[model samples]
Target: MRADAKKNYGRILEVARTVIAEHGSDASMRDIARRADVGLATLLRHFPTREAMFEALLCTNLDALTQKAVALESSNPPDVALRSWIREWVEFARSYRGVVTMMAAAHTNPASALYASCAAVHSTSARLLSNAQAEGTARPDMNGDDLFALMTALGWAVDQPSFAPRADHLVHLITSTVLLGRVG
Candidate 1:
């Protein structure tokens, strides 16, 4: 990328993060471009689509979550690490106002720009889950994908105003169920 193009791209992503956090995953690209002090054409040249822009914005958070999962594996017990990572995943899923919905939608759509990032998340989640299962800390019946779905469900629930107050309790309850009474 050219110097000016790279600068625009970085600026767009930086502004998009703030704009999307304020407005949600559905925030307009034009608004983001305006905030970034770029033209719509410039933004489009970089992101192409709204989902692509959202994906780019989310990539940093997703990468952090993946890295957290990796670090927890060696730093904590399997059960503790898995549960901790799930909590982190839930927080990541709910970071933006409507990000859980966007993640849910992108999670299954292989063609979506965010699919690769979501898949990487799932891969890391699976590693944690499989490790727990192997260590007899988690249920053998549920796979990583199942855990991912359950975590996302909890994320969506906690994102609601009604559930926001009890989010931690909800996370613990779901974690207990996922752990199948093996939590320690």
Candidate 2:
């Protein structure tokens, strides 16, 4: 991509993040084109589909999140590591509220690339769950899939309008119930 193309791509990601947050994954490429001040042809030239655009934005951020998960999980106690992972997740969710909904979609129906990328993200969560369970911090009856569902549930709670500035509370609640042995 040329410099102007890169700039347009960046603008498209920003506008797509907001538009998807407000209008959802089904939000039209035409609207995204409008918001980015690019022609529909340009938007299509850059991102051939809505999911393609979403994956572009998501892969950009989620890659950083995956790195953070690795660092945090390695350097903390098992339970603390788990909490930190959830904290990172909530941050991602708030930075792009569409994240909450997108993760749900990824669970069952994401495009191949999106699904594969999400599987990579889930690998981090699975490691945290395994570590916590081994340390007897998280519930043993649950596995990574269960933890993923719980985190997404917590994310949905945080994404609600009522959560507002206190979205972290949802992650805190989930940690207490699913990861931590006691509320602290």
Candidates in order have lDDT scores of 0.85, 0.80
Clashing pairs in 1: none
- Residue lDDT tens for model 2, 55-137: 89889788899999889977988888888888888777776665666667775565554786677767789899899989998
Clashing pairs for model 2 are none
lDDT, candidate 2, residue 79?
88
Quote the lDDT for 123 in model 1.
83
TM-score of each: 0.92, 0.86
Task: Please state the error at residue 154 of candidate 2 in Å.
Answer: 1.1
